[model samples]
Target: MTLVAFRYWLAGMSLALATLVTPLSTAQAISPLGGPRFAAVLMDADTNEILYAEQATAIRHPASITKVMTLYIVFDALDAGRLRLDDRVVMTPRAVSQRPSKLGIGVGQSLSVEEAISVVAVKSANDVAVALAEKVGGSEENFARLMTAKARQLGMRQTVFANASGLPDPAHFTSAQDIAILSAAMIRHHPDRYRCFSEQSYSYGRLRLANHNKLLGVVPGLDGIKTGFTNDSGFTLTASAIRGGRRLIAVVLGSPSGWQRDRDITTLLNTGFTALDIRRNGGIEDMPALLSSAGFTLNRSLRPVPQLATLDVEEGDGE
Candidate 1:
């Protein structure tokens, strides 16, 4: 069968198998946060088919993962000739005053649009994020409105953007499914620009900043994406990988720690790829069995609940 035909068939089969699996109950749906604060989704990026989900639609804080949408808007501006890579983005006092995990660019100092993108993608620079927002939307407040509009346009019904850098706000929120949709949109709409997410480190003058997503090089087939954390959001990640031309997007939100978050997403992607292979070779019946098996379950008992003090300061730096 042709590749397109095969993908369509596979999507149908996966959806059918999804119907057979029982949804997790409120008690069983608990996140590593010791509550129902977590949500996860694994999707076949190429087909946009959901392979597995746990409270995927639950609302949760997005933290610095909000930068993905920030960059998306920047990319759109670049594409429309409204912005240029070489154009300078000046740091306003407001941008410079943003919290830690920032570029530390001073007021009146400036960086090129391209440099701003790299800083935001690799370092999760909150200051640069605000600069980019202001550059694109005149003000961060207006930029957030634009972000919400774009999210709606992208069909992210549960997502609402409140800031450019994803600082804590009771108003800001998104879901695992919505984040998966955003990740897929980034891959689908801005394949070239998406490379920024894979950058391990970025340098400016005397300072060198590293990317927070640690699994980029360690996990085979894994590539560019983003990570986030906050007192309200916990640890969140949206990752994408490709193997044998098949790509998958996995999102894990509100984990207790970065270690558990990374580990959970890794497991999700690995299981997702294995399930795809089983569906492709062994048949659709084998796929569901694999996902439902005891071996595929995430071990939540071992996760340690972090201190409230730590969560207050752990936004974009650690992962």
Candidate 2:
């Protein structure tokens, strides 16, 4: 689709979205040619320089991207010795009640804290997220408060947390800039456990759940961070890639579809790498050539939506 038409299409899909949230910060950079209206940021992880930013501080619904904070808090607990990789997380009835994009563990059943981390990181499992929150904060509500407090400490000034699982709460919001802050903080503070974000899949008994972040395989140096979506938040991703000793974190919020989000991220990463003069393992190319050759627009290389039947939990409202 032409860029103009694509913007209108995106706007049409999100009419109700406008009233649900507002951008506290405005983006100055024009959306790159053939891109949709969204908020984004690209940063040099080591230098903490802004490589490119568009509505980076704009308030937007985080959807499941809120799990990045959920994991951050979990990682902090791990660092403090308050939680352990082998600690058991007993599934609460409240946890069992979360919506899909979840691990279907039953109430009273338990998995190790490390296993819970892998489940949420790889699968974006809502149930597991709530369980971790309960373990850490005694309740999801309390954990969300801690998430907001920690966000403040990390300088994610615009972020707020309504729940641990990142379900659709109007009050639950974050900016691309805040997400980048969270991503960078995780990399700096807990490098050891950050690999959970790059895991492609997690197995529970007979079922297997795949990571929603599609760029992990398609992008040369891309490692991970997270992916999130709800009808409310559109599709959002915070991704990091390393090449020639430099790392870049790119955040894209409010894409119309999963493929578009991936395409935009790939484009942003390509642009950021170019700006840094960092070459990919196979050499480098311009944005259009990089994207077209990588097949973002043409290929419908979406992360496969896991079949709900694969999860064993009883479902209720969730993201």
Candidate 3:
């Protein structure tokens, strides 16, 4: 098949694998973040305290950040001895033809579980994410169910997984609080596998994919977790950083661009550390007042405001 035709065919296969039929206009189901077009939260990973928040419970499309849960499942499988890093998973037509921000592994090619996880974590490869779902849950739908179930188990109360790759499905939604919980859980519950999130890049075949999480090297104490975006979801990120022995989890959703998303989260993290008197860079006065002026309800509990909804791959970032 021609490459374009093959992509359509694989999309069809993925739909069949999902066994889900939502209307094409389902994008209307959830509204994207309003106001500054942002929703964010910063939490004390150790104490589970909410340091700062703005619409933390607002429902938003997670985009490729859904891969974080996908990685959680893979880590669980490895822990249970159900999957091994070196066990090669053969790429089927379905996996090879997934949409872009992909590793572009060819059909009949094989990648070990570890390699797949690295690519998914770094590149946010749609193809490899489907392969992971197939490898562990027999299909993407089943794996998504597992992801949803695990979300409940982890107290990600607002999360629902419609697909493994976090493509634009209006039904695939999560909250800033929910994603923060997932990030903290990944670090607290599975310290061993959590290291994968910090990988700068992964080499598969001739492809060398660098991680899209920009905070890794730029922000001090920033370690992981993931970044995501789509036309509907805008630019989103779930990030974790450590300073002064305390680790903080910050989730920012629905920024206009990657730079704004990073800036908002950085400000939140800096403010969080400053609040705890652990900030190395600046004091509370040095913190940006954007949170309050931009309509974020900092230092207060806020109610969920209904529903809403990629990095630029060509710019060398992954969604």
The candidate scoring highest on lDDT is 1
The full ranking of all candidates by TM-score, starting with the best, is 1, 3, 2
User: Candidate 2 lDDT, tens digit per residue, 142-234?
Assistant: 777777767767887677787988777666677789999899999889898999988887787788888888788889889898987765556
- Model 3 scores a TM of 0.80
What residue runs in model 1 are displaced by over 4 Å at the alpha carbon? 1-36, 285-319
> Runs in model 3 with CA error above 4 Å?
1-37, 278-318
TM match of model 2 to true structure:
0.77
lDDT of 3 by residue, 47-85 (tens): 888877777876777788899899998898899898899
Per-model TM-score versus the true fold = 0.84, 0.77, 0.80
**What is candidate 1's lDDT per residue for 1-319, written digit by digit as tens?**
9853553355344333332342323333344555436678899999899888777777677788999999999999899898999999999999988887887868999999999999999989899999999998878977777777677778787776778998876566778899999999999999999999998888877788889999999888999799987766777899999998999999988777788788878888888888777787866644345645724444333455444325444344334
lDDT of each: 0.79, 0.74, 0.76
Best by TM-score: 1
